[model samples]
Target chain A: MKTFLILGGGTGGTMVANKMSHHLDPAEWKIIVVDENENHYYQPGFLFIPFGIYSPADVVKPKRDFYPQNVEFVLSKIEMIEPDQNRVKLEKGKRTITYDTLVIATGSRIAPGETPGLLDNGWHKNVFDFYTIEGATALSRFLKFWKGGRLVLNVAEMPIKCPVAPLEFLFLADWFFHERGIRDDVEIIFATPLPGAFTKPRASSILGDMLEGKNIKIEADFNIMEVDHTQKAIRSYDEREIPFDLLVSIPTNMGSEVIERSGMGDELSFVPTDKHTLRSKKWENVWVIGDAGNTPTSKAGSVAHFMLDVIVENILRQMEGLEPLAKFDGHANCFIESGFDKGILIDFNYDVEPLPGKYPLPGFGPFSLLKESAANHWGKMTFRWVYWNMLLKGEEMPFESQMSMAGKWK
Target chain B: MTNPILENVEFDDDGFMIDPNAWTAEIGEAIAAREELPLTDRHWVVINFARQEFDANDEAPTLRRITKTTDVDTKELYKLFPGGPAKKAAMVAGLGKPTGCI
Candidate 1:
């Protein structure tokens, strides 16, 4: 049987395995998934941990539980990927795994050390990140009794996973502190490298207004030079200083180390993939999905989910010696959780910014696009269930792979 | 803000070029002059690098990236471009305002 090797069995890899496993004839092809960890994390749930909304038990599960029995799951650290030879080397000097095809879903990770003084010593008792389980758990414990001062949530650079999360954190913090009867005591500050609250104009203006409404001061265009723990401030490249009593850092995010070691990634370690086709620019046989590839779209789970059909179709076409179709439109649909049981939905692709419209059921959506609603919040909450059940299984979703502007208004 | 060189140019609110192909070196000089930074050899190095990067990636390179790839180190870039070297350099380079990964 021909080996279909997938590296990093996270969201992308697992979903690919789930689809290709059933589609490819078992007698003709064998699917093997290699991941360092055995546990699968519902990463979006990490956002709720600090507010005591979700516990560790709510998010963590065995990785194998999501994968079908037909797929072989191996738990090991990937040492290198030899693209020329069509093989991958594992740690412990194990026999290299050869493959007829390769899929990279290694995903991105928090590299706080990329910044000066971020991890100079042990991280500050005041400084915390919610990107990791440990960080979220620790922050949850810290936020318990903290009579907060300036709670500065700073994003060090761009291309961070779930780009809207930093704003969501501050919004939730507003609701969180108000619920605790200490809203005024907790001065929330959002420091970002972007010129405004978000990347796009309409979304940024709306989100910026929300921040203003919630009494959160936004220190926009703040590119951090260094973190001064002694002074309790972050210095920008322009020498602007934003001080903080509690610093929630969205640090520099980079792709997996294995990508770097393989000499296959960009300066940020994101694989250079054709933005539309989802195929590697350097290799015809290789495919990149999720945060692993440098796609201009928001690096998000929904984006990955949207890419699934395109990748599967293209890979299959490639196997038949046909050219891969340039089908992916960089479609990304996200539920922006603006606390107090309210959320906003954004549906867009490469050409379209998040516009005001109805989605899925256009002009009759239970959820409103770019407008806050309770229904959208419910959708956001329900996504956790959908993520585990439908999304990972590569099941058919209501929306198509390409974004449509059926009911969008200018 | 009122320079004639900048008057007809299509640019965003942050003063980055809306269409990169519309950029000319003369306009780059005018942009640099508007920022109260006279175009020097040092400044052009950063601007050239930024322009080249924007052409390649359709996005301007970060200050850290500029420093790492070019001969000009971090402090030197700050000294030459002063306030926000990367964005300022991008603006002068006739590149669009970079929205990292939206």
Candidate 2:
């Protein structure tokens, strides 16, 4: 029997195992998934936790609950991947597992320690992040009793998971403070390394307008050099300073350390993957999926789901002595929550930029594209149900893997 | 707004016909012309399939369903619609916006 081993039992790993289990016959194949943690987080829900929108229970579950019966679930730390030997070493027992094929789905994580003085005096007290459950929970508590002041939301660097999340947090914060009758007491500021509101130009302008309408200040092109906890300020490399009473930051996001120890990753520990096929550029039998792969796309759940479809198809073809098709188009769509029961949706791919229009249904859409609407806000909320049901189950969805331009305008 | 392809034919904000039933061969040609696509017999096959599917299901057909039931392969479907096959083909065929996680 041929053995297929997958690392990281997160969204990508779990979906790949479930899909492959259905296609590869049990008589001819054995599948295994390894991860260091038992809990599976609905990472997207992390954005709402700070505002008491979703509790910790709503966003987390056992990692084993999502796996198939046929797939072996191993809970252990991966020490290294010896690709040349077709084996992996476990950190716990120093045991080894051999495989005919390997899938690297270990996703990215926030590295708060990477920033100088970020974890200093005000760590988790006044300085916090909504990227993790603990950080989000702590932030929720901090916001409950504390009188509002300068609430600065900063992105330490780029390529963070769910790039739109920080924007969501900012919008939600505006709503949260207003609801508490303290909107006047709070001064909301968004400091980012990017020149504008977002990476894409068209969407950025619309979002920037929304920010202006909300009176949220945008500290554009601010590159942070260090967080001075003593001064309650963030100092940039260029000597620019932004003071804050409460700081909610998205620190540097990096890939799993095991990828680095294995010497199979880039400087940031993300595996270099073919943007089309999702196959590891260095190894024939190795594939990278989700945030773990160094693909030039948004590290969002939607991108992972699209990548899984391509990777699964390519793996099946490769097993039959056929070349993998370059089917993935970097297709990604995101619903940006703008608070006040409104949001915007943006869909695009490697070759296309998002444009204004109605989505799914041309002239009669309930959801608007690149413009704020109540329908999109519901779409964002409804996605949690879709994620747990259709997406994680490896079930087929009505949409195609690639992005479509039919309902959009130039 | 009125579509340039057909007189008195209304288009939505996205340029799709307000009434899909109002679509004709000429409308398809005009839509394709606006998209800068030259329609061929091969393009008709996919468009016709999309229309048939939409009539029965009240929704646009996914690319998987199109390639599985029709002679057109995935690569050829992409070639027919340069950016996105299901979305572009559905638009040209006067179908509603696609539903699902494309």
Candidate 3:
């Protein structure tokens, strides 16, 4: 019998397990998913957490609640991936499980200590990160009753989970401060290593304009060397220091520790993966998805959602002794919350930069692309419902696996 | 734009070789040649601007904005470029060669 082992029952693993469990015959193939934690977080919701838009309760649930009924669910930590041996070691039981196919969906974690003094005395006190539930909950209480002060939003490094989240936090903070009647007193600054507000040209112009208009200060291409928590300041590699009262940091993100133990990952622990096929570069039967894959795309939930079909299709093809289809186009779409009851959506694939377009349908989208509208805001809110229901279950979304460029214009 | 050592030349729509263009022609060409260029030039403005749009707005800016903001018009911008500013800049940036946004 063919045995399939999926590591990390997060977004990628759960969806793929569900899709495979339904398609593969039970008599021939067995599916099992392993994860260290029981909680499944709606990571995108983390952006709203600091703003009190989503409490910890709203973003997390038991991982088992979303697993397919027939699949075996193992709640344990991964000790190592012995790819040559085709086995995975469990940390708790110290047992080894062999598999015909293995999928690594073990996502990333925040590494605040990577920066000097970040995890020191001010670790969760004066400086905070909302990437985790505990951090978000703590920050919410901290932000509450916190009178106006210099609030610096810092990105420790690139390749962090949910790249736009920091920007979203700034936008929401703008709204949050205004709502609190402390907009003027609270100084908001964005310090990033990127030359501009973003990686792409068009959106940067628009969003940069928006940032300037909103009075949020931007420091570009400023590589942070250390956070001097002792002095309440961030010192860039060039010795430029930005003093702050409250530091909302998006710490550096790295993949699972098990990948490092097995010598299968880069310095950041991200698995090197085929951009289209989702297969590990080290092994034939090994696959990886989500934030675990070192693919050059925003580490957002939508990218994982877009990768589901391609990964499942390739996995099935391997079983059939057929060439795996190299079809995933790094498809990523996201909703950008631009304070004041408006948001924007942009959809594109590997080769295509986002264009001004309508989504899901041509010229009739309920959401606007590249242009902020209230409908897009509504769409962003409604996605929480969709994620809990359709996405985790491996149900086919209305959109196609490959990004459609139909509604977009030059 | 032409690179002396890389044997690389800028191209137009028809794949015809072309001359250097843009506010930071020397730097853009240097990037294409795998050489480091100063990041502070206004030449970065277009690529940076385009990347910003691609990230937040997720679309390449129209030729109009790319020209207006970067101080390089469309004819010059599209010459060394292929289709979009992001693709061109990403290739020149050479940071793990973009997987074509797929």
State which candidate has the highest lDDT: 1
Cα lDDT of model 2 by residue, A92-128, tens digit = 7798999998999999988888789999989899999
Kept native contacts, as fractions per model, are: 0.78, 0.00, 0.07
Question: Quality of candidate 1's docking, in CAPRI categories?
Answer: medium
lDDT of 1 by residue, A134-206 (tens): 9999899999989878899999988899988898898899999999999978888899988899988888898
Better of 1 and 3 by lDDT: 1
Query: What DockQ does each prediction reach against the true complex?
Result: 0.62, 0.01, 0.07
Judged by DockQ, which candidate is best? 1
- Location of the lowest summed lDDT over 10 successive residues in candidate 3 chain B: B93-102
lDDT by residue for model 3 (A1-410), tens:
87899999988888888888888899998899999899999888877877788888899889999987889998898888899999988977787899999999998899887777888888778889999988888898898888989999998777778766777888999999999999999999999866677767676777788889889999885667788867899987555799999999988788888888889986577898988899997799999889998887878788998998889889889988988885788888989888888898878766777778788898999778888899999999999999999998889788987888789987
lDDT of 1: 0.88
Q: lDDT of each structure?
A: 0.88, 0.86, 0.79
For model 2, what is the alpha-carbon lDDT of residue A244?
99
Model 2, B1-102: lDDT tens digits are: 445656777777766777888888889988888888999999999999988987875667666568768899766887788755655798899876443221
lDDT of 3: 0.79
